[model samples]
Target: MIHLLRNLALVSIVLIAAGCDRIGAPVRVDDAWANATPAGATVAAVYMKITTKDADTLLSATTTVADHIEMHTNSEQNGMMQMRPLSNVPLEAGEPFTFAPGGAHFMLVELRQPLTAGLRFPMTLQFQHAPAQTVQVQVVELGSR
Candidate 1:
C-alpha cells in the first residue's frame, strides 16, 4: 500500500506541474519596454503589462542590468510628486496590470550601464503562487512615445 500511495503521489505531482504553463508563460507578460538612459544616467524604468493565471502577489523582481530593482508607485505628497517603493503588489487572477510612466513601475536603480535603444535584457518576476517568469525588455530611444 505504501508503494501504491507513493506512485499516486508522484502522479499527482506531475499532473499539477503540467497544469502550469512553463516558466515565463504562467505569468503572461506583454509590451515589455524600457527607456533609453542618457549618458551618465544612473537609473531607468521599465513598463509592461502582466496577467497571472492565478491570484498571486508580485513579491520582487531581478535583472542583470541594474544593481537592484524596486517596485515603485507614484504618489503626490505635500503638493509634490513622489515615488514610493512597494514591498509587494497583489494581482487578481486574469486581471491585467500595467506598469507605465507616471504610475506603478519597476525602477532599475543604480544601472551598471546606460540603457541604449534597441537593447534587450531579461527581468525575472517573482510571484507568490506562480513560478518566476523571465521577460525580455526592449529599450527604446528616450523622448519617443
Candidate 2:
C-alpha cells in the first residue's frame, strides 16, 4: 500500500507541473523603448506593457547591455518623485499592466555601454509561471516637448 501511495504522489506532481505550462502562452511587450540620454553621467528608463493570458509573475530580468536591471515604481513623496524597487509584481488573469515613465517601470542603471538612438538591445525576462521571454528593445532619440 505504501508503494502504491508513493506512485500516486509522483503522478500527481507530474500532472501539476504539466498544468502550469499551459497556464499562459507568453508575455507580450508593446511600445517598448529606451530613451536616449546625454553622453556620460545619465540614466534612462524603459516603458512597456507586459501582458499574459492567465495568472503569472515576473521573476527577474537580465540584459547584457546594462550592468543592472531592476523593477521600479514611481511614487510621490513630499511632492518629489521617488522610485523604489519591487521584488515582484502580480500579473492578473487576462489583465494588462502598463509600465510607463513616472509609474511602474524598469530601470536600467550603470550602463556599461552608451545607449544611442536607433540601436537595438536584447533583454530577457524570467517568469515564475511562464517561460523566459527575450525581447529586443529599440532606443529612441530624446523627444522635444
Candidate 3:
C-alpha cells in the first residue's frame, strides 16, 4: 500500500507540472515600432521582433488606429519592390522572428488618424498557442531603421 500511494503522488505532481506549463505566455515581443505615415496617407507599416518558446502562429492583429491590419512581405520582383499579403506568420521555437523594413511587416489600412512621429499606439497580437498580448508601438521617423 505504501508503494502504491507514493506512485499516485508522483503521478499527481507530474500532472500539476504539465498544467503549469500552459498557464503562462509562450511568446515575447520586443522592439515593436511603426513608421510615420505621409500626410493624408492611410497606410503605415509596423515592425517587431517576436520570440517564442514553442512553435506558434500569429493569427491576427488589431489596433484602434486602422480599420484592419494585414501581414505583408516585401520582395523584389523584376527589379521592383512589391508587397504581398500573408495569411499568417509562423514563429519557430527558440527563434526570433524579426519584422523589419524590406521584409515581413504589418500593414495598417484605413487609418482612423494619421500616424505621426513621436506618437504611440496600442497593438494587440493574437497567437495560435498563446494568449493575446498588447504592445505599445512607437511611431518613428519616416526613414527610421
Query: Candidate 3 on 20-107: residue-level lDDT in tens?
Result: 6875457789999988899899888899999887789999999999999999999999999999999999899878999898999999
Off by over 4 Å in 2: 1-24
| TM-score, prediction 3 | 0.85
Runs with alpha carbons beyond 4 Å of true place in candidate 1: 1-25
Q: Residue by residue across 79-105, what tens digits does model 1's lDDT show? A: 998999999999998899999999999
Best by TM-score: 3
Candidate 2, residue 32: the lDDT equals 77
> What is the lDDT of every predicted structure here?
0.91, 0.82, 0.91
Order of the predicted models by lDDT, top scorer first: 3, 1, 2
Ranking by TM-score: 3, 1, 2
- Tell how far residue 122 is off in model 1, in angstroms: 0.7
Ten-residue region with minimum lDDT total, candidate 3: 19-28
Among residues 3 or more apart in sequence or in different chains, the pairs in candidate 2 whose N, CA or C atoms overlap within 3 Å are none
TM-score of 1: 0.82
